[model samples]
Target: MKQILIAEDEPDIQELLCAYLEDAGYRTTVAGDGAQALAVFGGQPFDLVLLDLMLPGIDGFGVCEVIRRQSQVPILMLTALDGEESQLRGFGLDIDDYVTKPFSMPVLLEKIRVILRRRGLAGPESRLHYRDLSLDLDTREVLLAGRPLELTAREFELLHTFLAAPGRVFTREMLLARLWGYDFYGDERVVDSHIKNLRHKLGRNYIETVRGVGYRAAKADR
Candidate 1:
């Protein structure tokens, strides 16, 4: 069973998330404040974290930054802050997904399962090699002609999405749904930003844009 750390300041919300998640067959740990959340996280391993931006201390962003520095653990933020700036900031911090408050429990559960399932795909010996680029799923390590390439979690996952289906035209909307979850309702520029970054790191010739559409990794890059 995957363990989850749900950090929410409200007592009712905490119990709600905990009960629903457990009923969905996941082991859960709850933290009423950010400080307690950090402590619990440091002492134990969790498959995913449902963090709320409103907390007693060391807000969600702070905890996210700290955990990101130490591990690539998938973080799914739960915040009432629906503004684009806040959503972008969470993404910038390398969170896997962000869901605002007043979210549906069923949708939340689906998002959690999807993120954890994606995480589970990274096991020892899980790897993919295409052309001069090689990816070790377990480590989220990318290598181009044997040299390691550094990438943020989002960038890495984006790259995987393309490589996983070379030649498939993934529209911006498709990429957003696949990567950011269905609850995302912000500027589509987020996709463009990451694509630009990927092109820079993997070489401008790595991904091909289908002008007026989206992008795809040509088999030639394989």
Candidate 2:
């Protein structure tokens, strides 16, 4: 069974989240503070983490940075603060997803499911490969030229999406929605930024940008 760790200070919210996750058939561990959360995480194996921005001892961002330094476990940030700046900060920390407070349990559960699905831990292999480039969805590892390529969380997701359907043109808006987890919000440049970084690491010629449409992986023969 997939395990999840939830770090929230509010007793009521903690219980609610635990119950919902359990009902979804996920094994859950709960911590009321960031310190305790890190303790639990260090002591056990968890497939994912649901973290609140506000916590006693260490803040959520601190916990996230520390955890990221050690593991690539998917992290979902839960916050009462609903500002673009706060959300951008969470993204900068490489969070997989973010949820605002006053959220519905059903929506939260759905988000959890989506993240798990995207990670390919909830199902069989969803890997894609071409030439020496290989992406293992279950292991969340990308190997290029038989050597592992270290990528940020978002970059991995974006590359995975492209490799899943090679030769298919993906508009910038589509990529932003599928990988970034939302609509344009007047910031389509985010897709360009990620693509630029991905190409820089993967290969300048790996992804082809269609002049008037979008991007597609360069054909194997071409």
Candidate 3:
């Protein structure tokens, strides 16, 4: 998952931002002030930073300026200020985007999505990562703990669907429809066979049977 640093002082907004970002399948770290943000920035590699302009200590512009001096990490300024000067200044500081307060959370999510995509972190060739497993869509390859995996077409598609939605149960009927299509009048038992084969190839415990439900790619213990 892509990790983001959210530098917003207000506890309410900080909580709200963290909740939304995490719900969107991102790892988030929040800084209550600009200095904390800078500290966190220096300590770790982050995919992006959401900066609040009106912050205690250094302020967002200063943080952006300081970060710009060392790295080209994407920064989006979040502020209640909506003046041309503020926007121009943020842009001048090389901030990727700017958003005023009372912003829609969904819009913020979309902006982050676009920014990450542009940065090639979530683009077409971007690899999907879960645990030590990786799926390269562009190359149609699978890597388990950095080792290459040779999978059949059916197994590949099945594992692909499961990996796409870790922890989400996929019913036999749904799998049949998705993998074999409506025209495949064969027995649903094939789903179990494929799953068994896939599990054998991928570590056996990588997939979990939901007992009465169906199957899901077990969520990795992060």
Candidate 4:
């Protein structure tokens, strides 16, 4: 069974989330603080994480940064703060998604399902392929033209996002939001720089520039 970790402080919210997740046929673990969350995460393997932004010991962003350094586990941040800054900060920390505090249980469950589906963990088949490019979501491996391509964590994420839905136009902001997380205050040029580097290493033709729009993967030949 897929395990989901919920790092939330509020007992009421935690109970609600646990009940919903359990109903969805998932194994659930709860941590009331960031410290305990980290401990639980270190001790066992979890398929997904539902993280709360506010905590007693360590803040959610700090926990996210630390966990990201050690693992690529998908994180969905829950916050009562609805400002763009908080959302962006969570994203910058590599959070997979963000949910506002006054959220509905059904919506939260749907978001969890969507994230897992996108990561290929909730589906029966966990592999995605397009043309000569292939990604193993579970193992975090990428291959091109029958050969493995060495990619950094960010590069892998960028490529994964693009390949998830080929031919889709993703603006720099969108890409940054998905790859860098929401609270990134850095230059938008970072996206261009990464694309440039990715193109140089992967192949110039692998990612196509849409000029005023953004970047996209080349369409597969039918």
Candidate 5:
């Protein structure tokens, strides 16, 4: 499992992030301030860091600077500072990514996924398998029942998302922000359309509709 260090001062947001990240299969440690964050970071290894810029004591930039001087662990800034200057400063510090407050959890999670994958901290050349279906992340290929399955780019991504975490319900909004960019202004039904096509090609049993919620990969075959 990937280890993530979360440095934030807000209790509610810290708890929420811990729950979500743990549910997504990551091991996490929390730091309520920049000083504690640095202390914990020095005590152990971490695959990534979720930093809050407004952290009490030392602040995110200081903590980041301290860490950068020693290691290049990927750092993602989660802050209320959305201004270009703040963002530029974060980039100047070599943060892997920056996310402002009121951000989409799915989008943030996707950003973490991308950063880890890029750094080889996430499973490199990983293959996701659910029963007879397999997705080769490196090759961007999907196979069903040991046979090559052809899919559109969108369809493949949709399936990969599902298989990445079986039984995790993904709301249409979450899927939209994930597959399409967060700024996509298209209708939510576009997800339904792509899912419909994906089901038709990959077999309807592989994905399940969660009534009023959304969709999930059918539970792993027992």
Candidate 6:
């Protein structure tokens, strides 16, 4: 999974951003100020950074300068600074993209997707494999034990999600939001239905119920 560092002071926006990103399958770390952002950035590798310009200490520019000097990790500036000068300065500092406040979550997600895809950080592989199963991402084909297996679109996505992150239990709500979008008002039990179909098709050993939590991909046997 991709790791994203979010540097924002406002608690509401920080929580909102983290929830959306996590639902979309990215691991996120939060930093309330520029100093904290820098400290977190230096300690580990991250696929991307969501920066807020008006941070409490050091400021976004200072943080960007320090990070730019060390690594080329993609940075997307999320601030209320919409002026041409502010944007020009952010671009000049080598930020991959910039989004002014009051932005739509869908648009922000798309921007993150595009930036990661462009940088080759997104999952661009032709196929995904687990034990005897293989999924062709490009062709939307699945093979089981070297034989072709047919599946519905929802089943394919559910399997793909599970195979992408083995052992990551996905709640029905998370699966619904990620797969069906927030506008989906249908019963959440739809996720259970689809999972049942997938297990029927792929075999029960591939997915395991987490009892109270959700479901995760079963680990390969020794």
User: What TM-score does each of the candidates earn?
Assistant: 0.55, 0.55, 0.57, 0.55, 0.67, 0.59
lDDT of 6 by residue, 105-154 (tens): 65677688788889988734547899899988657799999999999877
Candidate 4 clashes between residue pairs 3 or more apart in a chain or in different chains: 88-182, 88-183, 89-183, 91-181, 91-182
Over 1-222, each residue of candidate 4 has an lDDT whose tens digit, in order, gives 689999999886787677546644678999999999999999999999999999889989988988999999999999989999999989988899999977755456557777888888863234678788887755768788878888887787678667666787779977664555444678999999888888787874777888899988876653
Determine which window of 10 residues in candidate 6 has minimal summed lDDT.
Answer: 175-184
Report the lDDT tens digits of candidate 2 across residue range 55-82. 8999999999999999999999999899
* CA lDDT, every model vs. true structure: 0.80, 0.80, 0.82, 0.80, 0.85, 0.85
The all-Cα superposition gives candidate 1 an RMSD in Å to the true structure of 12.4
Against the true structure, candidate 6 has what lDDT? 0.85
lDDT per residue for candidate 5 within 88-120, as digits (tens), equals 999999999999986766567778889998897
In candidate 1, residue 55 scores what lDDT? 83
Q: Clashing pairs in model 6?
A: none
| Candidate 6 residue-wise lDDT at 31 | 99
lDDT of 4 at 211: 86
Give the poorly placed runs of model 3, Cα more than 4 Å off. 123-222
Candidate 6: misplaced stretches above 4 Å? Answer: 123-222
What overall lDDT, based on C-alpha atoms, would model 5 receive against the true structure? 0.85
* Model 3: residue 148 alpha-carbon error in angstroms: 37
**Candidate 1's error at 44, in angstroms?**
0.9
The best candidate in terms of TM-score: 5
lDDT of 3: 0.82
Q: How does candidate 4 fare on TM-score?
A: 0.55
| Model 1 global lDDT (CA atoms, 0 to 1) | 0.80
Clashing pairs in 2: none
lDDT of 1 by residue, 1-222 (tens): 678899888876776676556544567899988889999999999888899988887999998998898989889999989999999999999999999977766567657766876877322234767678898765578999999999987788778767766677878876775567545798999999998998899874768889999998876834
Clash numbers, per candidate: 2, 0, 0, 5, 0, 0
